[model samples]
Target: MAFSPLVDQLLDALRVLPGVGPKTAQRMAMHLLERDRDGGRQLARVLMQAAEDVGYCQRCRTLTEQPLCELCESPRREDRLLCIVESPGDMLAIEEAGGFRGRYFVLHGHLSPLDGIGPDDLGLDALDAVMEQAGVDEVILATNPTVEGEATAHYLAQQLKPRGVTLSRLAYGVPMGGELEYVDGGTLSRAFMGRQPFND
Candidate 1:
Protein backbone atom coordinates (compact mmCIF):
# COMPACT_ATOMS: atom_id res chain seq x y z
CA MET A 1 0.00 0.00 0.00
CA ALA A 2 1.13 3.54 -0.79
CA PHE A 3 1.18 6.21 1.91
CA SER A 4 0.25 9.82 1.24
CA PRO A 5 3.05 12.01 -0.16
CA LEU A 6 3.47 13.85 3.15
CA VAL A 7 3.51 10.63 5.15
CA ASP A 8 6.01 9.08 2.75
CA GLN A 9 8.22 12.12 2.98
CA LEU A 10 8.16 11.98 6.78
CA LEU A 11 9.04 8.32 6.74
CA ASP A 12 11.91 8.95 4.35
CA ALA A 13 13.24 11.74 6.52
CA LEU A 14 13.02 9.61 9.65
CA ARG A 15 14.87 6.81 7.89
CA VAL A 16 17.88 9.11 7.55
CA LEU A 17 18.58 8.57 11.28
CA PRO A 18 21.14 5.94 12.11
CA GLY A 19 19.74 2.42 12.72
CA VAL A 20 16.29 3.59 11.59
CA GLY A 21 15.06 1.32 8.80
CA PRO A 22 12.04 1.85 6.61
CA LYS A 23 9.72 -0.12 8.89
CA THR A 24 10.88 1.74 11.98
CA ALA A 25 10.57 5.09 10.22
CA GLN A 26 7.06 4.22 9.05
CA ARG A 27 6.08 3.19 12.58
CA MET A 28 7.53 6.42 14.00
CA ALA A 29 5.75 8.55 11.42
CA MET A 30 2.47 6.75 12.11
CA HIS A 31 2.88 7.12 15.88
CA LEU A 32 3.64 10.83 15.55
CA LEU A 33 0.64 11.37 13.23
CA GLU A 34 -1.82 9.25 15.16
CA ARG A 35 -0.86 8.99 18.79
CA ASP A 36 0.92 12.28 19.58
CA ARG A 37 0.63 15.04 17.03
CA ASP A 38 1.12 17.69 19.73
CA GLY A 39 4.37 16.08 20.87
CA GLY A 40 5.48 15.93 17.25
CA ARG A 41 4.81 19.64 16.87
CA GLN A 42 6.79 20.39 20.00
CA LEU A 43 9.65 18.19 18.78
CA ALA A 44 9.68 20.05 15.47
CA ARG A 45 9.79 23.41 17.21
CA VAL A 46 12.61 22.35 19.54
CA LEU A 47 14.58 20.79 16.71
CA MET A 48 14.29 23.94 14.64
CA GLN A 49 15.29 26.15 17.54
CA ALA A 50 18.26 23.99 18.40
CA ALA A 51 19.38 23.82 14.79
CA GLU A 52 19.29 27.58 14.59
CA ASP A 53 20.81 28.41 17.99
CA VAL A 54 23.07 25.53 19.00
CA GLY A 55 26.71 25.80 17.86
CA TYR A 56 30.14 24.56 18.77
CA CYS A 57 31.92 26.05 21.76
CA GLN A 58 34.65 28.50 20.75
CA ARG A 59 37.14 26.94 23.15
CA CYS A 60 36.27 23.22 23.20
CA ARG A 61 34.49 22.74 19.88
CA THR A 62 31.67 20.92 21.64
CA LEU A 63 28.03 21.74 20.96
CA THR A 64 26.82 24.66 23.03
CA GLU A 65 24.33 27.52 23.03
CA GLN A 66 26.87 30.02 24.35
CA PRO A 67 30.28 31.17 23.10
CA LEU A 68 32.09 29.01 25.62
CA CYS A 69 30.73 25.76 27.06
CA GLU A 70 29.94 25.47 30.75
CA LEU A 71 33.04 23.38 31.35
CA CYS A 72 35.27 25.96 29.68
CA GLU A 73 33.64 28.72 31.71
CA SER A 74 33.94 26.84 34.99
CA PRO A 75 36.75 28.06 37.21
CA ARG A 76 36.96 24.80 39.14
CA ARG A 77 38.10 22.72 36.17
CA GLU A 78 41.81 21.94 35.82
CA ASP A 79 43.11 24.27 33.13
CA ARG A 80 46.47 22.58 32.55
CA LEU A 81 44.95 19.15 31.96
CA LEU A 82 43.24 18.91 28.57
CA CYS A 83 41.39 15.79 27.47
CA ILE A 84 41.03 15.38 23.70
CA VAL A 85 37.98 13.45 22.54
CA GLU A 86 36.54 12.68 19.13
CA SER A 87 33.11 13.96 20.00
CA PRO A 88 31.00 15.70 22.63
CA GLY A 89 29.39 12.32 23.28
CA ASP A 90 32.75 10.89 24.35
CA MET A 91 33.37 13.90 26.60
CA LEU A 92 29.94 13.43 28.18
CA ALA A 93 30.64 9.77 28.78
CA ILE A 94 33.90 10.62 30.54
CA GLU A 95 32.10 13.26 32.59
CA GLU A 96 29.48 10.72 33.65
CA ALA A 97 32.28 8.43 34.79
CA GLY A 98 33.37 11.29 37.11
CA GLY A 99 36.74 11.97 38.78
CA PHE A 100 37.93 13.85 35.68
CA ARG A 101 38.08 17.55 36.55
CA GLY A 102 40.18 18.59 33.54
CA ARG A 103 39.14 20.71 30.59
CA TYR A 104 38.31 19.02 27.24
CA PHE A 105 39.01 19.59 23.53
CA VAL A 106 36.43 17.89 21.35
CA LEU A 107 37.76 16.94 17.91
CA HIS A 108 34.15 16.54 16.72
CA GLY A 109 35.48 13.64 14.59
CA HIS A 110 38.42 11.33 14.07
CA LEU A 111 41.03 11.56 11.30
CA SER A 112 39.98 9.63 8.24
CA PRO A 113 42.26 10.36 5.27
CA LEU A 114 40.20 8.12 3.02
CA ASP A 115 37.14 10.17 3.84
CA GLY A 116 39.05 13.47 3.37
CA ILE A 117 38.70 14.36 7.09
CA GLY A 118 42.08 15.96 7.83
CA PRO A 119 43.63 17.81 10.74
CA ASP A 120 42.02 21.08 9.64
CA ASP A 121 38.62 19.41 9.53
CA LEU A 122 39.18 18.08 13.07
CA GLY A 123 40.16 21.64 14.13
CA LEU A 124 43.66 20.71 15.30
CA ASP A 125 44.88 24.22 14.50
CA ALA A 126 42.28 25.59 16.87
CA LEU A 127 43.39 23.00 19.41
CA ASP A 128 47.00 24.17 19.06
CA ALA A 129 45.88 27.73 19.64
CA VAL A 130 43.94 26.66 22.72
CA MET A 131 46.94 24.77 24.08
CA GLU A 132 49.11 27.86 23.71
CA GLN A 133 46.54 30.25 25.13
CA ALA A 134 45.49 27.99 28.00
CA GLY A 135 49.08 26.93 28.74
CA VAL A 136 48.00 23.32 28.68
CA ASP A 137 50.55 21.05 30.39
CA GLU A 138 48.98 17.66 29.73
CA VAL A 139 46.85 16.37 26.85
CA ILE A 140 44.97 13.09 27.26
CA LEU A 141 43.97 11.52 23.96
CA ALA A 142 40.62 9.88 24.58
CA THR A 143 39.68 8.93 21.09
CA ASN A 144 37.82 5.61 20.70
CA PRO A 145 39.49 2.18 20.36
CA THR A 146 38.82 1.96 16.66
CA VAL A 147 41.53 2.02 13.97
CA GLU A 148 40.69 5.56 12.97
CA GLY A 149 40.76 6.62 16.59
CA GLU A 150 44.22 5.09 17.05
CA ALA A 151 45.49 6.85 13.95
CA THR A 152 44.06 10.12 15.16
CA ALA A 153 45.73 9.74 18.53
CA HIS A 154 49.12 9.01 16.95
CA TYR A 155 48.77 11.94 14.61
CA LEU A 156 47.93 14.21 17.54
CA ALA A 157 50.91 12.95 19.51
CA GLN A 158 53.25 13.83 16.63
CA GLN A 159 51.61 17.17 15.99
CA LEU A 160 51.92 18.20 19.64
CA LYS A 161 55.40 16.76 20.15
CA PRO A 162 57.18 20.04 19.44
CA ARG A 163 54.94 21.91 21.84
CA GLY A 164 56.58 20.01 24.75
CA VAL A 165 53.18 19.26 26.27
CA THR A 166 52.78 15.92 28.02
CA LEU A 167 50.72 13.59 25.79
CA SER A 168 49.02 10.32 26.75
CA ARG A 169 46.46 8.00 25.17
CA LEU A 170 43.62 6.35 27.02
CA ALA A 171 44.29 2.68 27.73
CA TYR A 172 42.25 -0.01 25.99
CA GLY A 173 41.73 -3.37 27.62
CA VAL A 174 39.18 -6.03 28.52
CA PRO A 175 36.07 -4.77 30.27
CA MET A 176 36.02 -5.02 34.06
CA GLY A 177 33.54 -7.89 34.07
CA GLY A 178 34.43 -9.46 30.71
CA GLU A 179 35.92 -12.93 30.72
CA LEU A 180 39.25 -13.63 29.04
CA GLU A 181 37.80 -16.66 27.29
CA TYR A 182 35.16 -14.59 25.53
CA VAL A 183 37.37 -11.58 24.85
CA ASP A 184 38.59 -10.95 21.31
CA GLY A 185 42.26 -11.45 20.45
CA GLY A 186 42.96 -7.75 19.90
CA THR A 187 41.33 -6.83 23.21
CA LEU A 188 43.23 -9.55 25.04
CA SER A 189 46.49 -8.33 23.57
CA ARG A 190 45.69 -4.75 24.53
CA ALA A 191 44.80 -5.83 28.05
CA PHE A 192 48.09 -7.71 28.43
CA MET A 193 50.11 -4.88 26.94
CA GLY A 194 48.42 -2.19 29.02
CA ARG A 195 48.45 -4.18 32.26
CA GLN A 196 49.59 -2.35 35.38
CA PRO A 197 50.93 -3.87 38.59
CA PHE A 198 48.06 -4.80 40.87
CA ASN A 199 47.98 -2.89 44.12
CA ASP A 200 48.15 -5.04 47.20
Candidate 2:
Protein backbone atom coordinates (compact mmCIF):
# COMPACT_ATOMS: atom_id res chain seq x y z
CA MET A 1 0.00 0.00 0.00
CA ALA A 2 1.09 3.55 -0.69
CA PHE A 3 1.83 6.05 2.06
CA SER A 4 -0.83 8.55 3.17
CA PRO A 5 -0.89 12.01 1.60
CA LEU A 6 1.04 13.68 4.46
CA VAL A 7 3.72 10.96 4.50
CA ASP A 8 4.01 11.09 0.72
CA GLN A 9 4.34 14.88 0.83
CA LEU A 10 7.10 14.67 3.43
CA LEU A 11 8.93 12.09 1.36
CA ASP A 12 8.75 14.28 -1.74
CA ALA A 13 9.97 17.30 0.18
CA LEU A 14 12.92 15.38 1.60
CA ARG A 15 13.89 14.22 -1.87
CA VAL A 16 14.48 17.83 -2.89
CA LEU A 17 17.84 17.69 -1.08
CA PRO A 18 20.78 17.04 -3.32
CA GLY A 19 21.69 13.32 -3.86
CA VAL A 20 18.57 12.16 -2.01
CA GLY A 21 16.66 9.44 -3.83
CA PRO A 22 13.14 8.11 -3.32
CA LYS A 23 14.23 5.22 -1.07
CA THR A 24 16.49 7.48 0.98
CA ALA A 25 13.73 10.02 1.35
CA GLN A 26 11.33 7.27 2.45
CA ARG A 27 13.84 6.00 4.94
CA MET A 28 14.36 9.49 6.33
CA ALA A 29 10.63 9.99 6.74
CA MET A 30 10.20 6.62 8.41
CA HIS A 31 13.13 7.27 10.74
CA LEU A 32 11.69 10.61 11.72
CA LEU A 33 8.27 9.22 12.39
CA GLU A 34 9.30 6.00 14.14
CA ARG A 35 12.19 6.97 16.38
CA ASP A 36 13.23 10.61 16.02
CA ARG A 37 10.12 12.79 16.11
CA ASP A 38 11.71 15.33 18.46
CA GLY A 39 14.89 15.48 16.39
CA GLY A 40 12.85 15.94 13.25
CA ARG A 41 10.89 18.76 14.86
CA GLN A 42 14.15 20.43 15.90
CA LEU A 43 15.50 20.04 12.39
CA ALA A 44 12.37 21.63 10.95
CA ARG A 45 12.62 24.57 13.33
CA VAL A 46 16.31 25.17 12.63
CA LEU A 47 15.82 24.82 8.88
CA MET A 48 12.99 27.34 8.86
CA GLN A 49 14.99 29.78 10.97
CA ALA A 50 18.10 29.44 8.83
CA ALA A 51 16.13 29.86 5.60
CA GLU A 52 14.49 32.99 6.93
CA ASP A 53 17.49 34.59 8.63
CA VAL A 54 20.47 33.64 6.50
CA GLY A 55 21.51 36.01 3.74
CA TYR A 56 24.57 36.74 1.61
CA CYS A 57 27.26 38.87 3.19
CA GLN A 58 27.20 42.44 1.93
CA ARG A 59 30.95 42.53 1.28
CA CYS A 60 31.97 38.97 0.37
CA ARG A 61 28.65 37.25 -0.48
CA THR A 62 29.18 34.36 1.93
CA LEU A 63 26.08 33.07 3.72
CA THR A 64 25.49 34.81 7.05
CA GLU A 65 22.87 36.31 9.29
CA GLN A 66 24.28 39.84 9.27
CA PRO A 67 25.11 42.58 6.82
CA LEU A 68 28.67 41.29 6.46
CA CYS A 69 30.02 37.83 7.19
CA GLU A 70 32.36 37.44 10.15
CA LEU A 71 35.35 37.15 7.88
CA CYS A 72 34.65 40.43 6.13
CA GLU A 73 33.98 42.14 9.45
CA SER A 74 37.20 40.87 11.00
CA PRO A 75 40.15 43.22 11.40
CA ARG A 76 42.83 40.54 11.32
CA ARG A 77 42.30 39.14 7.81
CA GLU A 78 44.49 40.67 5.12
CA ASP A 79 42.77 43.24 2.91
CA ARG A 80 45.27 43.21 0.07
CA LEU A 81 44.56 39.61 -0.93
CA LEU A 82 41.18 38.29 -2.08
CA CYS A 83 40.34 34.67 -2.79
CA ILE A 84 37.43 34.10 -5.17
CA VAL A 85 35.57 30.86 -4.66
CA GLU A 86 32.57 29.32 -6.38
CA SER A 87 30.48 28.81 -3.25
CA PRO A 88 30.22 29.31 0.50
CA GLY A 89 31.08 25.63 0.83
CA ASP A 90 34.37 26.29 -0.93
CA MET A 91 35.09 29.22 1.33
CA LEU A 92 34.46 26.96 4.32
CA ALA A 93 36.89 24.39 2.98
CA ILE A 94 39.65 26.99 2.69
CA GLU A 95 38.91 28.24 6.17
CA GLU A 96 39.11 24.71 7.59
CA ALA A 97 42.47 24.26 5.91
CA GLY A 98 43.82 27.28 7.90
CA GLY A 99 46.25 28.22 5.16
CA PHE A 100 44.84 31.48 3.86
CA ARG A 101 44.61 34.68 5.88
CA GLY A 102 43.16 36.84 3.13
CA ARG A 103 39.62 38.01 2.54
CA TYR A 104 37.25 36.24 0.16
CA PHE A 105 34.63 36.80 -2.54
CA VAL A 106 32.07 34.06 -3.03
CA LEU A 107 30.88 33.64 -6.63
CA HIS A 108 28.00 31.32 -5.59
CA GLY A 109 28.36 29.53 -8.97
CA HIS A 110 30.46 29.27 -12.10
CA LEU A 111 29.82 30.50 -15.63
CA SER A 112 27.77 27.83 -17.36
CA PRO A 113 26.51 29.17 -20.66
CA LEU A 114 24.60 25.98 -21.40
CA ASP A 115 22.73 26.46 -18.12
CA GLY A 116 22.21 30.22 -18.63
CA ILE A 117 24.64 31.10 -15.81
CA GLY A 118 26.88 34.07 -16.53
CA PRO A 119 29.19 36.59 -14.89
CA ASP A 120 26.23 38.68 -13.87
CA ASP A 121 24.65 35.67 -12.20
CA LEU A 122 27.93 35.08 -10.36
CA GLY A 123 28.07 38.76 -9.22
CA LEU A 124 31.32 39.58 -10.97
CA ASP A 125 30.38 43.25 -10.94
CA ALA A 126 30.14 43.17 -7.19
CA LEU A 127 33.54 41.51 -7.07
CA ASP A 128 35.03 44.21 -9.26
CA ALA A 129 33.53 46.86 -7.06
CA VAL A 130 34.99 45.24 -3.98
CA MET A 131 38.40 45.02 -5.59
CA GLU A 132 38.29 48.66 -6.58
CA GLN A 133 37.20 49.76 -3.14
CA ALA A 134 39.48 47.52 -1.14
CA GLY A 135 42.58 48.21 -3.27
CA VAL A 136 43.19 44.50 -3.55
CA ASP A 137 46.74 43.71 -4.68
CA GLU A 138 46.22 40.03 -5.52
CA VAL A 139 43.25 37.87 -6.46
CA ILE A 140 43.32 34.08 -6.20
CA LEU A 141 40.89 32.23 -8.41
CA ALA A 142 39.90 29.17 -6.41
CA THR A 143 37.06 27.96 -8.56
CA ASN A 144 36.65 24.21 -9.13
CA PRO A 145 38.80 22.44 -11.71
CA THR A 146 36.08 21.88 -14.28
CA VAL A 147 35.51 23.17 -17.80
CA GLU A 148 33.01 25.76 -16.61
CA GLY A 149 35.27 26.70 -13.71
CA GLU A 150 38.26 27.14 -16.03
CA ALA A 151 36.26 29.29 -18.41
CA THR A 152 35.06 31.40 -15.52
CA ALA A 153 38.60 31.82 -14.17
CA HIS A 154 39.94 32.82 -17.57
CA TYR A 155 37.17 35.34 -18.00
CA LEU A 156 37.91 36.79 -14.57
CA ALA A 157 41.61 37.04 -15.39
CA GLN A 158 40.86 39.01 -18.55
CA GLN A 159 38.55 41.39 -16.74
CA LEU A 160 40.78 41.99 -13.72
CA LYS A 161 44.14 42.16 -15.49
CA PRO A 162 43.44 45.58 -17.06
CA ARG A 163 42.82 46.96 -13.61
CA GLY A 164 46.52 46.33 -12.74
CA VAL A 165 45.67 43.68 -10.18
CA THR A 166 47.79 40.55 -9.85
CA LEU A 167 45.41 37.77 -10.83
CA SER A 168 46.33 34.13 -10.26
CA ARG A 169 44.61 30.75 -10.36
CA LEU A 170 45.10 28.14 -7.68
CA ALA A 171 47.93 25.79 -8.66
CA TYR A 172 46.75 22.53 -10.15
CA GLY A 173 48.95 19.59 -9.17
CA VAL A 174 49.01 16.13 -7.75
CA PRO A 175 47.89 15.98 -4.15
CA MET A 176 50.57 15.57 -1.49
CA GLY A 177 51.39 11.86 -1.05
CA GLY A 178 49.23 10.96 -4.09
CA GLU A 179 50.68 8.42 -6.54
CA LEU A 180 51.35 10.02 -9.92
CA GLU A 181 50.32 6.80 -11.67
CA TYR A 182 46.77 7.24 -10.43
CA VAL A 183 46.54 10.95 -11.38
CA ASP A 184 44.35 11.84 -14.37
CA GLY A 185 45.83 13.15 -17.61
CA GLY A 186 44.30 16.61 -17.26
CA THR A 187 45.67 17.06 -13.74
CA LEU A 188 49.05 15.74 -14.81
CA SER A 189 49.12 18.27 -17.66
CA ARG A 190 48.21 21.09 -15.31
CA ALA A 191 50.87 20.02 -12.84
CA PHE A 192 53.43 20.06 -15.63
CA MET A 193 52.32 23.47 -16.86
CA GLY A 194 52.47 24.84 -13.33
CA ARG A 195 55.79 23.20 -12.49
CA GLN A 196 58.26 24.95 -10.20
CA PRO A 197 61.89 24.42 -9.25
CA PHE A 198 62.74 22.23 -6.30
CA ASN A 199 62.77 24.13 -2.99
CA ASP A 200 65.12 21.88 -1.01
Candidate 3:
Protein backbone atom coordinates (compact mmCIF):
# COMPACT_ATOMS: atom_id res chain seq x y z
CA MET A 1 0.00 0.00 0.00
CA ALA A 2 1.31 3.41 -0.96
CA PHE A 3 1.47 5.96 1.82
CA SER A 4 0.03 9.40 1.20
CA PRO A 5 2.53 11.93 -0.12
CA LEU A 6 2.33 13.94 3.11
CA VAL A 7 3.11 10.90 5.26
CA ASP A 8 5.97 9.88 2.98
CA GLN A 9 7.37 13.39 3.02
CA LEU A 10 7.25 13.55 6.81
CA LEU A 11 9.00 10.21 7.10
CA ASP A 12 11.68 11.24 4.62
CA ALA A 13 12.27 14.49 6.45
CA LEU A 14 12.58 12.73 9.80
CA ARG A 15 15.00 10.19 8.35
CA VAL A 16 17.63 12.90 8.08
CA LEU A 17 18.27 12.60 11.83
CA PRO A 18 21.14 10.40 12.88
CA GLY A 19 20.35 6.72 13.62
CA VAL A 20 16.77 7.18 12.34
CA GLY A 21 15.97 4.72 9.64
CA PRO A 22 12.99 4.29 7.38
CA LYS A 23 11.09 2.13 9.87
CA THR A 24 11.59 4.53 12.77
CA ALA A 25 10.79 7.52 10.59
CA GLN A 26 7.62 5.90 9.34
CA ARG A 27 6.62 4.98 12.87
CA MET A 28 7.25 8.52 14.07
CA ALA A 29 5.25 9.95 11.20
CA MET A 30 2.37 7.63 11.97
CA HIS A 31 2.49 8.50 15.64
CA LEU A 32 2.52 12.20 14.88
CA LEU A 33 -0.39 11.86 12.46
CA GLU A 34 -2.49 9.67 14.70
CA ARG A 35 -2.11 11.05 18.21
CA ASP A 36 0.29 13.98 18.54
CA ARG A 37 -0.63 16.87 16.29
CA ASP A 38 0.11 19.49 18.94
CA GLY A 39 3.36 17.87 19.96
CA GLY A 40 4.39 17.57 16.32
CA ARG A 41 3.60 21.23 15.72
CA GLN A 42 5.66 22.19 18.75
CA LEU A 43 8.54 20.05 17.51
CA ALA A 44 8.31 21.66 14.09
CA ARG A 45 8.30 25.12 15.59
CA VAL A 46 11.33 24.38 17.74
CA LEU A 47 13.14 22.81 14.78
CA MET A 48 12.52 25.85 12.64
CA GLN A 49 13.50 28.24 15.40
CA ALA A 50 16.74 26.37 16.13
CA ALA A 51 17.59 26.14 12.45
CA GLU A 52 17.05 29.87 12.00
CA ASP A 53 18.44 31.30 15.22
CA VAL A 54 21.09 28.86 16.41
CA GLY A 55 24.63 29.37 15.18
CA TYR A 56 28.20 28.49 16.07
CA CYS A 57 29.91 30.51 18.80
CA GLN A 58 32.47 32.88 17.22
CA ARG A 59 35.13 31.72 19.68
CA CYS A 60 34.43 28.06 20.56
CA ARG A 61 32.42 26.93 17.54
CA THR A 62 29.74 25.51 19.85
CA LEU A 63 26.13 25.91 18.72
CA THR A 64 24.40 28.82 20.40
CA GLU A 65 21.47 31.15 19.99
CA GLN A 66 23.82 34.14 20.25
CA PRO A 67 27.05 35.24 18.59
CA LEU A 68 29.04 34.03 21.61
CA CYS A 69 28.00 31.10 23.77
CA GLU A 70 27.39 31.47 27.51
CA LEU A 71 30.66 29.73 28.29
CA CYS A 72 32.64 32.22 26.26
CA GLU A 73 30.84 35.18 27.79
CA SER A 74 31.02 33.94 31.36
CA PRO A 75 33.69 35.74 33.46
CA ARG A 76 34.15 32.79 35.80
CA ARG A 77 35.60 30.51 33.13
CA GLU A 78 39.41 30.44 33.09
CA ASP A 79 40.78 32.22 30.04
CA ARG A 80 44.19 30.55 30.07
CA LEU A 81 42.92 26.97 30.15
CA LEU A 82 41.30 25.68 26.96
CA CYS A 83 39.87 22.21 26.42
CA ILE A 84 39.59 21.24 22.78
CA VAL A 85 36.91 18.76 21.78
CA GLU A 86 35.59 17.28 18.57
CA SER A 87 32.06 18.68 18.79
CA PRO A 88 29.49 20.57 20.84
CA GLY A 89 28.10 17.27 22.08
CA ASP A 90 31.47 16.48 23.60
CA MET A 91 31.49 19.87 25.22
CA LEU A 92 28.08 19.19 26.71
CA ALA A 93 29.29 15.88 28.07
CA ILE A 94 32.22 17.56 29.77
CA GLU A 95 29.97 20.30 31.08
CA GLU A 96 27.62 17.71 32.53
CA ALA A 97 30.58 16.24 34.40
CA GLY A 98 30.80 19.55 36.24
CA GLY A 99 34.52 19.26 36.90
CA PHE A 100 36.06 21.33 34.15
CA ARG A 101 36.17 24.98 35.19
CA GLY A 102 38.02 26.22 32.12
CA ARG A 103 36.92 27.27 28.68
CA TYR A 104 36.59 25.12 25.56
CA PHE A 105 37.38 25.15 21.86
CA VAL A 106 35.01 22.99 19.83
CA LEU A 107 36.61 21.66 16.64
CA HIS A 108 33.18 20.56 15.29
CA GLY A 109 34.89 17.49 13.87
CA HIS A 110 38.15 15.58 13.78
CA LEU A 111 40.66 15.32 10.94
CA SER A 112 39.79 12.65 8.39
CA PRO A 113 42.00 12.90 5.32
CA LEU A 114 40.21 9.99 3.68
CA ASP A 115 36.99 11.98 4.06
CA GLY A 116 38.73 15.13 2.72
CA ILE A 117 38.61 17.07 6.01
CA GLY A 118 41.80 19.00 6.90
CA PRO A 119 43.03 21.63 9.32
CA ASP A 120 41.43 24.46 7.39
CA ASP A 121 38.12 22.66 7.29
CA LEU A 122 38.21 22.19 11.07
CA GLY A 123 38.74 25.96 11.71
CA LEU A 124 42.41 25.84 12.70
CA ASP A 125 42.77 29.51 11.82
CA ALA A 126 39.96 30.41 14.21
CA LEU A 127 41.65 28.31 16.89
CA ASP A 128 44.93 30.10 16.30
CA ALA A 129 43.20 33.44 16.57
CA VAL A 130 41.58 32.40 19.84
CA MET A 131 44.89 31.15 21.21
CA GLU A 132 46.57 34.44 20.40
CA GLN A 133 43.72 36.71 21.43
CA ALA A 134 42.78 34.84 24.59
CA GLY A 135 46.39 34.22 25.64
CA VAL A 136 45.54 30.56 26.19
CA ASP A 137 48.07 29.00 28.59
CA GLU A 138 47.08 25.33 28.41
CA VAL A 139 45.27 23.42 25.66
CA ILE A 140 43.76 20.06 26.59
CA LEU A 141 43.31 17.94 23.45
CA ALA A 142 40.04 16.25 24.38
CA THR A 143 39.32 14.74 21.01
CA ASN A 144 38.06 11.14 20.96
CA PRO A 145 40.44 8.20 21.30
CA THR A 146 39.82 7.09 17.72
CA VAL A 147 42.50 7.12 15.03
CA GLU A 148 41.11 10.22 13.36
CA GLY A 149 40.74 11.95 16.71
CA GLU A 150 44.35 11.13 17.64
CA ALA A 151 45.57 12.45 14.32
CA THR A 152 43.65 15.65 14.81
CA ALA A 153 45.02 16.11 18.34
CA HIS A 154 48.60 15.52 17.16
CA TYR A 155 48.21 17.95 14.26
CA LEU A 156 46.77 20.59 16.56
CA ALA A 157 49.48 20.09 19.20
CA GLN A 158 52.21 20.49 16.57
CA GLN A 159 50.62 23.60 15.14
CA LEU A 160 50.09 25.19 18.56
CA LYS A 161 53.46 24.19 20.06
CA PRO A 162 55.22 27.18 18.57
CA ARG A 163 52.60 29.41 20.15
CA GLY A 164 54.06 28.45 23.58
CA VAL A 165 50.84 26.93 24.97
CA THR A 166 51.00 23.87 27.21
CA LEU A 167 49.32 20.89 25.50
CA SER A 168 47.69 17.89 27.19
CA ARG A 169 45.48 14.93 26.23
CA LEU A 170 42.66 13.32 28.17
CA ALA A 171 43.50 10.18 30.10
CA TYR A 172 42.68 6.73 28.66
CA GLY A 173 39.60 6.15 30.81
CA VAL A 174 37.55 6.78 27.68
CA PRO A 175 37.72 3.51 25.76
CA MET A 176 39.82 3.35 22.60
CA GLY A 177 37.85 4.58 19.57
CA GLY A 178 35.09 5.89 21.87
CA GLU A 179 33.59 9.31 21.47
CA LEU A 180 33.64 11.76 24.37
CA GLU A 181 29.91 12.41 24.02
CA TYR A 182 29.15 8.79 24.89
CA VAL A 183 31.32 8.59 27.98
CA ASP A 184 29.59 8.90 31.36
CA GLY A 185 29.98 12.06 33.45
CA GLY A 186 32.06 10.42 36.16
CA THR A 187 34.44 8.84 33.65
CA LEU A 188 34.80 12.04 31.67
CA SER A 189 35.46 14.04 34.86
CA ARG A 190 38.11 11.58 35.94
CA ALA A 191 39.65 11.64 32.46
CA PHE A 192 39.87 15.41 32.57
CA MET A 193 41.28 15.32 36.08
CA GLY A 194 43.93 12.78 35.09
CA ARG A 195 44.88 14.31 31.73
CA GLN A 196 48.47 13.76 30.67
CA PRO A 197 50.78 15.98 28.66
CA PHE A 198 50.65 15.42 24.93
CA ASN A 199 54.30 14.79 24.05
CA ASP A 200 55.36 14.87 20.38
The global C-alpha lDDT for each of the candidates, from Candidate 1 onward, is 0.92, 0.93, 0.90
Q: How well does each candidate superpose onto the true structure, as a TM-score?
A: 0.95, 0.95, 0.85
Instruction: Give the Cα RMSD of candidate 1.
Output: 1.2
Deviation in Å, model 3, residue 123 alpha carbon:
0.9
Candidate that beats the other on lDDT, 2 or 3, i.e. the better one: 2
Residue 135: error of model 1 in Å?
Answer: 1.4
Candidate 1, residues 2-41, lDDT tens digits: the string is 8999899999989878999999998899899999999999
The residue-by-residue lDDT of candidate 2 on 3-57, one tens digit each, is 9999999999999899999999999999999999999999999999999999999
Error of 3 at 128 (Å): 1.1
Residue 142 in candidate 3, Cα distance off native in Å: 0.5
lDDT of 3 by residue, 54-157 (tens): 99999999999999999999999999999999999999999998999999999889999888988888888889889889878999999998889989999998
Global CA lDDT of candidate 1, please?
0.92
Model 1: which residue pairs collide? none
Stretch of 10 with least lDDT, candidate 3 = 169-178
RMSD of each: 1.2, 1.2, 6.6
